[model samples]
Target: MAKLFTPYKLKNMELKNRVVMPPMCQYSVDTKDGMPNDWHQVHYISRAVGGTGLIIVEMTAVHPDGRITDQDTGIWDDRFIPAYRQMVDAVHSYGTKIGIQLGHAGRKAEDANPPVAPSAVRYDGEGYKEPRALTTAEVEEMIEAYAEGARRAVEAGFDTVEIHGAHGYLIHQFHSPLVNQREDEYGQDLPLFGERVVQAVRKVVPADMPVIMRVSAREYVDGGYDVDYITEVCRRYRDAGADIMHVSSGGEGPVGAGGMPVGPGYQVEMAAQLKRALDMPVIAVGILDEYEDAEQVLENDQADLVAIGRAMLRDPYWAVHAAKALQAEADVPVQYARGYRH
Candidate 1:
């Protein structure tokens, strides 16, 4: 059997295959209320029909100001639960597990009234304005927003929840020393923000529901957190109740400073390194485009799971096609079976 078609278990969740549709911002939601509309339903349902074992929805904000785009999905209020529930139900109907990526954009919040961060540093050239420093009380509120978002995710019937701690977002800003220059508790310690977020989310999420931490392993900038630092962060997050480490790189310091050079499985080594250093499951993402590449990552035990982003966007049926090319039995939809024969 092809390694990519093999089933894997993370905590209590069993994924039918290693093919995961990583979260990609659609910027397609209705801006009026941050609700999932027909566009989201069609976009996500297409992936499910196309045959990905796991489908992680795009970066969903815990609060309105946390959005990367005005059209991004939001789980901040109970009103949004029904829309997500409809989408989740649709994805599950196709026998695919669905997960949500919950996050706060911090200083990167893409509006005039962006939320406060640990510092006032602007993400240079990323079009993000300098944000005000969040007061301790406001920080506590943001933590509650995350916990509440997790609760709503449960209500929405998602199989899992992933905390967005990478790509120089709100949590990433707190983790990078270059961005977080405060002398307070959140900045005096490197892992303070991440630790708190994990702990808070765990408190609200069901114990059986896996909470994955998506981390940017290498900041890829001077004075930014490197693999060593991220490895340590992974260890700490595991201790704080993270079920898996979804390893990806870039998005620290200046916009382009941490830009990861694109190539096949470019960031797989980060997952491989973290797998060696930690006892938790590690997911390798970025530039994973083919069956052999994914097989190598799994066969070598570099990553317990493989996540595909842009490639999956290009071809939602990539997983089923890869399974066929690799000569593995893939669960292709009956509607498309005839095309596969030719």
Candidate 2:
């Protein structure tokens, strides 16, 4: 009876509900081969059984050096495809659509021998190592790598693929002038890197397979870009073939007085802004945990979808719980029906 449980169609993938299980790294790849092992299969399949509509697997690396930790899943090689196929098949069996967040951690790649970024500056926090500036040639290669990873995702049977451009990763590094201090084309055109990556990814996947781009709508640090600039960048991404924008905030640098408020639906405004600017479906994420709060986001037209992160991590059955709390039809598994009987 709530919009949160309504079926929403994007491209060819139709979600059973608007509750999205945003990617949270499991860091359980014991082989370091970037393949999803039994842990990954169980982790994601459980969410499907728990009734999440769209489950985007953790930030999977496009290259080995792109991983934040060596344990992060990857699609950098064809060998990873079969493993992903197994998980995709398992998740889909529960009527849940699956996707993967393909990204390169860049300077944040703690496991890399010497991390790379658009510039040589190290991240400004503790435990961050200095990074080398990616050569012009390497930049081009990274784009191709993203395309290839996307290609692999399709082969692995994903309903969609998300480009992890948010949270100060490689794509975010290029979008934010605070980190992209180069003399070349990328520096002159900050959003060029993201646009190119989007275009590259679009070229590799099936035309019907939706491409979602996660973006930081506002940077918290001084001199960093704001919602206005990010809206423009998102426009470019939309033009470059992104179907949805996963709107988030901060992570470019340290927070300041102007940063986002610490409360529920804090970043919903950013998602609403992007939806208005780009005229595209947008996912709002950031502390939106409560069923009523999530419903309000949709009721107010703030976002097309609501991503539950920490809450979903705490309770895999978050969607089911929210459905019951809101008096909507809860998508409980038949095998568990006895537990829900009045």
Candidate 3:
């Protein structure tokens, strides 16, 4: 049997396989309320029925303006808990553990009247607003918001929680040299904000459940940090409380050759490097949709898990298909057993 179908565990969150459905925002919220609707339910629950080991819910906002667009989900208030509880319970019924990625969009918030970031540096992208810099006090408030979001997640019955510290969001802005030009604590210590977020999240979550943190190993933008630098930064986050590093790349600015390769497994080396450097389990993502390619990652010891994004969007039963192809135990629900029978 391939390791892709083998059960894996992290702290208290045990999985039926090594497949992970990384958070990809649906932007399907009908109202500006940040609640998960029927669209979210069918989208996620179908994947569970299809046999994904661990499903990380899309990057949900910790504050209102934290969302990239008004269509994204948010957990800034308690009223949102019941809706998430429904989603979480539905996903669990099929034996898949679910977690939510809590994040803040910072300067990239498309709907924010004027977004905020560590520095006044506007994303400078088309249609983006010039964001005001967050006050030091507001930054602290933001950290607490993350903690509160986790608290609500627990009440909603999430099996685990992920901190969205990658892809040039608020935590990323605080750490990226170009995005963060402040002279204060966060700037002086690039990983401080992320660490504080980890610590705060740890405070609310159960001591047994592992915390997953998604990080960009290297930036595609010129002058942005590299894998080597990000590894050290991640070391700080690990010490703070993050147990797994979901390694991805770029989003801070425009794409330029930052020396990272492109193509299948292009991001695996970065994940491998961080796994070696940080001594923490890592999830390798980007273009690893092919069954063999995804299996090769684990076989090669590059990453503890592989995330299938676009491919899974096309077919919810991607994990089941991979199992059949690999001749491993396919987690086909009994209702659909006839479809997968040889």
lDDT of 2 at 178: 87
* CA lDDT, candidate 2, residue 35: 79
**What tens-digit string does per-residue lDDT give for candidate 3 at 36-99?**
8999999999999999999999999999999999999999999999999999999999999999
Cα distance off (Å), candidate 3, residue 327: 0.3
Tens-digit lDDT string for candidate 2 (1-342): 799999999999999999999999999989887878888888899999999999999999999999999988888899888889999999999999999999999999988979999999998888889999999999999999999999999999999999999999999999888899999999999999999999999999998889999998888888878889998889899999999999988877678667657799889988998999889999999998888999999999989999999998889999999998999999999999889889
- Candidate 3, residue 33: Cα displacement in angstroms equals 1.1
Residue 217 lDDT, candidate 2, scale 0-100: 89
Each candidate structure's TM-score, on Cα atoms with residue i matched to residue i, is 0.96, 0.98, 0.98
Considering summed lDDT, which 10 consecutive residues are worst modelled in model 1?
252-261
Better of 1 and 3 by TM-score: 3
CA deviation > 4 Å runs, candidate 2 = 257-260
The RMSD (Cα, Å) of candidate 1 is 1.6
Candidate 1 stretches with Cα past 4 Å from truth are: 255-260
Candidate 2 lDDT: 0.93
Kindly report which residue stretches of model 3 are placed more than 4 angstroms away from their true locations once superposed: 257-260
User: Which stretch of 10 consecutive residues in model 3 shows the poorest summed lDDT?
Assistant: 253-262
For model 1 the local lDDT of residue 103 reads 93
- What is the Cα-based TM-score of model 2? 0.98
